[model samples]
Target: MKADFLLIGQGLAGTILSYRLFRAGYTVHLIDDAHPSASSRVAAGLYNPVTGRKMIKTWMADILFAEIEPFYQEMEGFLNQKLLHPQGIFRPFISFEEQNEWLAKSADDQFEGFIKEVFTGPQFPGVNDGMGGLLLKKAGYVDIPVLLQAYRTWAKSQGLMTEAVFSRNQLKRGKDGDWEYQDLTAGGLIFTNGIRAKDQGFFDWLPFAPVKGEILTLRQDFYSSKIINRGVFRIDLGNGLGKVGATYDNRNIDLEPTAAARQEILDKLRQLIPEKVLEILHHQVGVRPATPDRRPILGKHPSEENVYLFGGLGAKGVSLAPYFSRKMVDFLHSGEEPQKEVNINRFFKYI
Candidate 1:
């Protein structure tokens, strides 16, 4: 059986790319084991225009969000679900330097596109230590677990998805520069295995520093319709439940969520709304596929043209993934050029 592409893994990277490929009239065969460590499953899937203490806007937020907005909208409509949220994030500023840096960046012309001067008074009492901060417009959350489930079901129904974990032993390189796996042959193969990318054979040459994240679900008042917090993220998950995340650890791979991380999250949440009633609903941990350079490793394997990869979005996978997936598909389909910053060619010399 001939296929345009054989996509490995059904995480955000694989799902988004395969979905777009199908929409673009390509025949794709997807396979996955649905590992719980998949980042998309545990991700809060929030998109903040500006991230980190540097107070800089996320790399290419306007362009990425613009292209991705309609893509997710179409997915939601197809699934008959609301998968994307346009709710803005109001970050709590804890230090004077934090507020000052935000103000400095807000003054730049680049930031004007995404950030609106946050003039609103504190909606959450005791939030930000009375330090007002910036509001990034048109940024919000994606219900990643919901989207993943919906996409998986759709792909399964279409006979485009398989339940097996794609094995390297099953792959055979053709003499003509292509790949064959069992009864299926493809012009190219893409590995979107999330944190598991480190375990892949040919593509493992790229640097991947994995990070572990732990998130806790907490109960808010059922009447609380607002998504406000200075902590990691605050959202209206409905039925008095809101999810707060994510503690970062570089060394641990234990998927078991810990009480220590839960306590840290709760403490941070309290700084924003001190007197609020809450309950710990659940906690979960997942591994993030972080690269040494913090940019995604995209491109073909050094010795093979058919083997390619799209991993290492770190914590920004929810926001940056859709755009990069589309880029990878285009590059594979039409020989379109990828931005030098993200292409794996930069690391080829070292590898």
Candidate 2:
């Protein structure tokens, strides 16, 4: 089989890039074994313009937010599924001082697009927001598993995807300076395999600080329209169900859902809201492919021709993938250079 590009992994990074390349009229093939612990499958898929304990705008929020909704809506139309939920996010202020600060920030022209409302009092039932909170626009979660599954089904029907473990040993350089893997030959090969990239020969020197995160689904009586995000996040899934989560632990890189993580999440959940948990529906864990600098790594390999990487999205993959994947497609199709910060050339010194 011949293709313009052969991509490794079908997680968020790989799936988004492959779809973009396909849309650009390129023949692309993917090799993905469907790793159970892949971060995309386990992620809550939240995209908030304002995040963290400091309640500041996320990195590249303007550019990233601009593309997020439209890109997901396009994918939804293609797949005939409802994937993007633009329900917005509500972050409660920790103190009166923080509330006053945000009230002042709401008037700043810089925050015009993202700020939805600055509530001075509690807005919902069964909640604990006494000192007001910041309501943000252009914020929501993506149903990542549904998106990946639908895209995989479509890709399979088109003969663009193969389900198998990718072994580097079987990959060889063809006489024509292309990549040859099994019977497949491609002009270029891209590694979008998430944390596995650290061990994937060509880009090991690039610093990858993997962090493990765990999320829990619970059956609860309390509900809210907006995503309640403070210490942790609570997403109302309707029908008396809600999803709360995400404990970050960089030391423990394994996929196991620990009791400690569960307790930590519940503790944080308590701080965010006063909702009672009726039942614990599920608990899941995934190790995110984070970088020390918290920026995505993109572009071609320094020594190997036509080899590239598109990983290091970390916890923000839902927001970062679409925009950066478009950037990557442009780089691959038109020979355009990606920005220096995200371009792989920045790390050539380590290589």
Task: Please tell me which predicted candidate would have the highest TM-score against the true structure.
Answer: 2
Best by lDDT: 2
Off by over 4 Å in 1: 95-107, 125-129, 174-177, 222-231
TM-score to native of every candidate shown: 0.91, 0.98
lDDT by residue (tens digit), candidate 2, 56-156: 78988999999999999999999999999988798877788988899899998878899999999988777788877888999999999999999999999
| Model 2 stretches with alpha carbons more than 4 Å out | none
Write the residue-wise lDDT of candidate 1 on 160-238 in tens digits: 8889977888889887778989888898888888767657677656767888898877776633333454555667688
Score residue 322 of candidate 2 by CA lDDT. Answer: 94
Q: Residue 172 lDDT in model 2?
A: 96
